[model samples]
Target: MAEEEKRASPEPPLPSPPESSSQPEHPPPETSTPPATFDPSRMIGIIKRKALIKDLAAAYHVECLALCRELLELQKRKDEPFLDTKATEDLRKETLRSSSKRAKKKR
Candidate 1:
């Protein structure tokens, strides 16, 4: 009966030790050199392509900024009314003269 009671109430499992914070849980990846198949010319080509793309993107950005400034200036001009009566009179006179010439031509 005593042996049966001891078997029934077994000792609790031992607690595991806490992990050390000083060491990382996973090992660092190993650094490796480029493969023997690597070609220096191919690497240079890729670098040149990247530089060309960067330059093109910069130029495109500058062009867009310039266009935006021009559009804004145009909008400002459009908002203002042209107050040149002399220019308007000249245009009107030219139109009349052209119409008279056209009428003469029709004759």
Candidate 2:
């Protein structure tokens, strides 16, 4: 009776394979990619932002140097004219970095 019942019950069917897509399996080559784009207005905004940061940094540096100079003067002898450090004049000659130089340093 058990053997007859097992033979009467049919097995479930197997699942079919997935269908293929229209696009290629692998991505297209870089050389075949679309041409690069340029936006003048967006670029100008970046340039303006960089300049603003530079100005702010310069102002901050000058303020810090002024505080250090005052501290030095108070600690030093009255006979000493001023701080002899070369960086003392850095306030007058602030470093101006170009975009090219900055990009190279990043790499």
Candidate 3:
């Protein structure tokens, strides 16, 4: 049996930089912007304000619908009793027609 001796290969040399250029070098990007800190109080106030506005908007919508119904009823028969079935039917029809028209307009 013959024994073979193994030789280690030499490592590759690192690449050299190119010759200096006449152009002015630009600096690396700056990332010194401070991270935004959380303000719990301000956040809570904003959330509260948003919730209040949303609730007010919802209330306003309900009030507007009721007012519209009432106005339609009043315009239909100024002196008629509110307990009359005909007035109620007219108000319902007006409300439904107005709502459908608004929906169509939106689309």
Candidate 4:
């Protein structure tokens, strides 16, 4: 039985950079926010403000919906004549006839 010995291959080196940039190889340190301290008064004030904003928003929403409905109704009315065309025409003719009769009677 013949024993064969395997040669270990060498890994290629990384490409060299053209210029040394100002940037560091490692990323900049993360900015950390200050730890929050529990304040009952501040929390209560925030909750109250949030509730007030919600109430105001709801009121405005209702008002906006009302305005939208009014606008839609007005638009629909605009599409329809205030006095129907046939009725108005008949009324105008009747008025003219009545006026002519009154003028004849005055004569």
Best by lDDT: 1
Q: Provide the TM-score for each candidate, comma-separated.
A: 0.39, 0.38, 0.35, 0.44
Q: What is the C-alpha RMSD of each candidate to the true structure, in Å?
A: 17.1, 25.5, 16.5, 12.1
Better of 2 and 3 by TM-score: 2
After superposition, candidate 1 runs with Cα above 4 Å error: 1-37, 82-107
Q: What is the lDDT of residue 81 in candidate 1?
A: 57
Instruction: Encode model 3's per-residue lDDT on 1-107: one tens digit a residue.
Output: 12333234455888998758864598667789877789898899999999999999999999999999999987878656655877899999999998887555554
Return the lDDT, model 2, position 15.
82
User: Any residue pairs clashing in model 1, and if so which?
Assistant: none
- Order of candidate numbers by lDDT, starting with the best: 1, 4, 3, 2
Query: In model 4, how large is the Cα lDDT of residue 27?
Result: 88
Clash count for each candidate, listed in order shown: 0, 0, 0, 0
lDDT on C-alpha atoms for all candidate structures: 0.87, 0.77, 0.82, 0.84
lDDT of 4 by residue, 12-92 (tens): 788897766887888877779667899899999999999999999999999999999999999879867855786889999
Winner by lDDT between candidate 4 and candidate 2: 4
Candidate 3 — which pairs collide?
none
Q: Model 2 shows how many backbone clashes?
A: 0
Check candidate 2 and list the clashing pairs.
none
